[model samples]
Target chain A: MSLARVHNFAISLDGFGTGFGQSKELHFGHAGDRLHQWMFGTQSWQRTSGSRGVDNVFVRDTDVKIGAEIMGAGKWGHPGWEDDPDWKGAWGPNPPFHTPVFVLTRHQREPIEMEGGTTFHFLDTTPAEALETARKAADGKDVRIGGGATVIRAFLAAGLIDHMHLVVVPILLGRGVRLWGEDIEGIEKDYVIESTPSPSGVTHVTFTRKA
Target chain B: MSLARVHNFAISLDGFGTGFGQSKELHFGHAGDRLHQWMFGTQSWQRTSGSRGVDNVFVRDTDVKIGAEIMGAGKWGHPGWEDDPDWKGAWGPNPPFHTPVFVLTRHQREPIEMEGGTTFHFLDTTPAEALETARKAADGKDVRIGGGATVIRAFLAAGLIDHMHLVVVPILLGRGVRLWGEDIEGIEKDYVIESTPSPSGVTHVTFTRKA
Candidate 1:
């Protein structure tokens, strides 16, 4: 079975996945890159210059067995990205995700093939349908739920996530799109959670669903 | 110089100090004891039966070098506690805080002396005024900012907290009063934050103001 997973989803101390007033330029809004500075310091992020530590270990785990990805529209591009027909993803020509990436958006567009083994497939479907499509594309491998918070919350609310890796950043974003909602109350009952704080000052929280 | 500190204040993964709909019976509301289960498991909690670990280390740190405590009215008593003039406190006749405790409330009442060294002093004052009173009572010792979330937010907003020890529990209390607010957007710039995750599935986050 292809597992639905979320890897290295960073949130502020106040549980905001991304800061308020997200724009085409400032993807994280006022938060900037504060939430992900820890990951960027890891060897897996820089690939050549960063150090090998607990952060690198977790960062390296992100791409392992991730054959397909389902990401929110906000993550795929900036606001009103659907309106732009010539929109290539934020990852330039060769995106980091070398898989069939399913972008969840209301306005569906034709699949766009990129430099790497990546293809952007836009879908206007429900979480279950999207997961099903991503699972089929995964082809016996795991399906990664790439997020900007909303999509992850949707999948989590639907009880579709098998494994979740959330990095709790120490800084407080104050106001933004929060990860946890009322629908996710008592969600811990379904998963066994573990927390590991790295020397880099971020806590890695993993939630694995019960067998 | 005495510092204003917050110790062992447990917040959910969603950054809620206490859950929504707080009442006399349900002090932490929907959160119940989920956020505090880590502290309850520590050696400092049971005193005789609990294990000595990271949780205990932080738990023990809670009472060290603290002469006075400044807590919110919510922390001192339940909602509508003011109506009952005879109401002593939730900690029974003998409270845990062995210091002159100042409770921030709109309705000021006469001070109540408990069996322990704790004396509840009701004060209708601002954060600065309350801190001034607590600091005076502290007598060169640190004044702990004991919280139920609102009081902590007020102190943080006022930039009165010198050192804060926040425990990030694994559970997500989907709805509650949050610790951080719009007034504290760039508050992280003032504090040097440190995170340490314990085996008990909780991360102890400490914030020390930059001098």
Candidate 2:
């Protein structure tokens, strides 16, 4: 069976995956790119110039076989990008994700094909339904959960994730979207967790689903 | 020039220092000793026969020169211990804290002298006031912030904590008292942060105040 996976998702010491007041100018609000600076320093995100240390090892799966990508509306575009007809996405023409991207949003729109084999499909469905659609679209390959915390938290609550890689940054983003919530207590029972600390002041924690 | 420091404080992956329904039986509530199992394995807490690994390094500060400790009332006793006059702190006859320990609460009580060098003094005061009393009791030595989350969070919010050591456990407590709250945003600016992951499935994060 193809697994549901998440990779290189960053969260603060307080578990905030993204900060509050996100906008076109500040994609991560007051947090800016503080949460992702570790990933940026890795060749996985840059694909060219970066470190070859412990961080790169975790981020090395940038070219993993992901048949489909499921992301939230906030991660797709700004807060109100649905009204803007010209907003194809934050990515100029070609997004990093080269798969059938399922954008979970209440404001459903027609699928928009991007460069480099990336396509955006809007959906207004529940977590299980969305995962089912994404899995079918994945076509025997793994389905990647592209997150902004809120989306990943929902999938986690729904118990749809099989493997997740979370990079816990040392920074404290006081207020923002949390990857963990009160609704998903004892979630650790479903998976075996391992953590590796990087020299870049980040802890890479991976949770793999139990057999 | 005594510095205010915190050591070996444990919290869940969701940042809950302690779980809900804290009673006499359940000192740490639903969290029980799950958050502290790492510390329990360390020679620092055991005083003998424990692993001498990376985790032991962080927990090796049991003999640190701390002349005084300030903790929350919840840490001092159970639910309604104020009603029961015979109640001493949870540490039993001879407490672990061998110094002047101040318990913050509304109902003031006479000092309870334990078998060890520990003396419990109940006081109703603000964070600053509590620190002043602790510092005096410390008498040039360092004052440790003996916490139960709420007390530590209060000190952090009041800008009274000079150094803090937080151990992040991998468990997810769906409901509990969170150490990091929405009120104290952007707390990272005041300190220099560092994280080290141990094989015991815990990340030891230290925050030292900027000079």
Inter-residue clash pairs, candidate 1: none
TM-score of each: 0.96, 0.96
For model 2, residues A1-211, the per-residue Cα lDDT tens digits are: 9889999999998899889899999999888989988878877667777888989987777448789999999999988898898899898998888889999999978899999999999999998999999989988999999897989989999999999999998777888888888888999999999988888988889999999
DockQ-based CAPRI category assigned to the predicted complex of candidate 2: medium
Interface RMSD of 2: 1.3
Tens digits of per-residue lDDT for model 1, B61-157 = 9889999999998988888998998998898888999999998889889898889799999988899999999989999999999997889989999
Model 2: chain B TM-score vs. truth?
0.96
Candidate 1 lDDT tens digits, A1-211: 7899999999987788999888899898888999989988977878788979988888889889989999999998888787888988899999999999999998878899998899999999999999999989999899999997999999999999999999988787888998888888878889999888788888888999999
Which candidate wins on DockQ?
Answer: 2
After superposition, candidate 1 runs with Cα above 4 Å error: none
Judged by lDDT against the true structure, how good is candidate 1?
A: 0.89
- TM-score of candidate 1 chain A against the true chain A: 0.98
Alpha-carbon lDDT, every model: 0.89, 0.89
